[model samples]
Target: MIRKLFLIASLLAPLPAGAEPLANKLFAAEKSPSTQESMPIGTYAKGCAAGNVELPETGPTWQAMRLSRNRNFGQPTLVQFLEDLSVTATKIGWKGLYIGDMGQPRGGPMNSGHASHQIGLDADIWMLKPASLTLSRKEREKISSVAVRSADQRSVTKYYSPQHAALLKAAASDPRVDRIFVAAAVKIAMCKTAKASDTKWLQKIRPIYGHDTHFHVRLKCPAGASLCQTQKPSVSDLSKGGNGCDETLAYWVSDAYLNPPKPKPSKKPAKPRPPVKSARTYVLADLPSQCAAVLSSR
Candidate 1:
């Protein structure tokens, strides 16, 4: 009976492990107000945040989903950006925006969900606009957003619309946003639809994996945040302020998309792979040195 109860409880929890470390648990469970001085430390994929703020669950034109995850947290700038972007989206014929995960309360590697939202600058906005801005807590928890891509992962489905492109453009146009990640099909659609004058914002819209259901927004390292690490821009990144439609979009639709080459077979039998470690198993040493201080602080 005890074993069955344990199994039932585990299924209800989102974390991969039954128990986490002291420091990991502390940072994960914090729900206090953000510190006055916002500081981001390290790159998006591997970093931590200080003075994180929580986005209100319900806003005038937006509602945050997945409240159980406790991930609706980020720097002050990120929270403000979402609120402002949602209002912008409403003005352009979009119903409203449904926000997904932002970052942890303190912003670090989470036990699950994402590898990049470790910094407070990253946020995920569901592609499916809510029917109403005021979603109840129960509805937010039960509702699931539909993916924009088809099963083959090659193109956008019927769920996509011109308003989707407008919504993305509005977010990209913000000076605070560094880049946005969407599925290849979404990027292709935007390239074909956006006006030439709006192509500059489209350049910041990058193609990444598993973004058909929602788009990922990354903010620039805020000024005065000296400790924050910025990602090195690729040489082809809007080179001389040119549009990205020619080469990058073409690659997603080429033969590489339909038939990828099989890996070369090894002559010797494959060795047994080692067991993977879950995020909960990670110790203080696995994280950046500065993260310890961030976790220990109020």
Candidate 2:
């Protein structure tokens, strides 16, 4: 009994001096929220959240996927937006939304999966139209979202449907959303149906690599939210009031990007640079000062 007690005590001992712990590990260990007011602190990719709330694993209009990951937590604004969107899904012929990771309980950098979800304002919604919202937790783990993009990455497959487009439109139209990310092929398909006079909603849907089976939604900082930060150059300014269906979109699926030419031979090979430190490398000192408090709060 004494030997077992000594081993347990050693495991609980504090880190040695001059050692800094990874912020992701620190946040992931927090299974419950902090005892503080709800607030998303710092930038989306590099911050923490206080008083984050967890979405019920199963709801009438939505089911949070990957239950064992314990990442269904988000700010109150995000939770409401998701619930509202799920109801919208029913109107669009889908049973409900199958939500993915939202954030860690305290909302800091994660050890895996994402970097932006650290703020509790970002979420991944599966592209698969759920036939049933009553999926058992075990089944949710085994089931996978259907891929909408073709393997060539130049166009969407038969899996991309009108209902999926409608769902994307509704989410982007929401006032709470700042931007959404989808596969470039999906956006190209969306562009073809957009009317010249009414395509402003498409501006919020940005194209990035991957996301063939899911779309990522990011919310704007809530009103009166303290310590929250937004990216520069508003989406409208970047889009110039036009739907994002221009040369930029074309370039994403172009051969120059999808099938790039080989680099020319060089006289000397370039030296490898040290890895840049980011969310995955950030220590407590690298994040917002208040993040330390959030991580330590009971």
Most accurate candidate by TM-score = 2
Model 2, which residues run further than 4 Å from truth?
1-18, 234-239, 269-274
Give candidates' CA RMSD values in order.
7.3, 4.4
lDDT of 1: 0.80
Q: What is the per-residue lDDT of model 2 for residues 29-59, given as tens digits with 9 covering 90 to 100?
A: 8899988899999999999999999999989
Per residue, candidate 1 scores C-alpha lDDT tens digits across 1-298 of 6764664444333454534353346557666534446888777876788888889998888898999889998988999999999888888787678999999988877777777787799999998967888778888999989899777777899999988888888888889998899998888888888777658878778887788899999999999888788877642556576666778677876678657898899999999999765445555445666766566554
* Model 1 CA deviation exceeding 4 Å by range: 1-26, 33-36, 235-241, 268-282
Residue 286 accuracy (lDDT) in model 1: 57
TM-score of each: 0.84, 0.92
Q: Residue 224 lDDT in model 2?
A: 87
Give each model's whole-structure lDDT.
0.80, 0.89
